[model samples]
Target: MIISWWKETKSIKEVFVVFCRVVALLLILIFALVGLVELFVYLGIAQDGFIIQRD
Candidate 1:
């Protein structure tokens, strides 16, 4: 279904442009998520690695 839709609707250039846009958005989202995680860790509200407890 998707293949047929693509074949009928968009040209190669249009498909390439769409693919680039999707990739760019994905990269932006990944960076934003990583930045937020780093910010949380920097604020001491989160931690990295394993935590150990001793009695």
Candidate 2:
């Protein structure tokens, strides 16, 4: 992966494949973080209205 960043790609497809993988991983991380935060709020372990308001 480090080599990809420095090395030239033979085709645009290679660049896009790497780019898509990185994007997918980032999205997964973001959604995981959001899910964990929501779980915390649901459990009352987190402060209400600080992260989200409870009704």
Best by lDDT: 2
After the best TM-score superposition of candidate 1, give how far the Cα of residue 34 lies from its true spot, in angstroms.
0.4
Model 1: how far residue 42 lies from native, Å: 0.6
- Candidate 1 versus truth, CA RMSD in Å, comes to 6.5
Candidate 1 on 1-55: residue-level lDDT in tens? 3543665646777667767777899999989877787777778876742132224
Q: What is the C-alpha lDDT of each candidate?
A: 0.67, 0.76
Steric clash pairs (candidate 1): none
Candidate 2 deviant stretches above 4 angstroms: 1-3, 6-8, 49-55
Backbone clashes for every candidate come to: 0, 0
Model 1, residue 5: distance off in Å is 4.1
Q: List runs of model 1 lying over 4 Å from the truth.
A: 1-9, 49-55
What TM-score quantifies how close candidate 1 is to the native fold? 0.69
Worst 10 residues of 2 by lDDT: 1-10
**Top TM-score: which candidate number?**
2
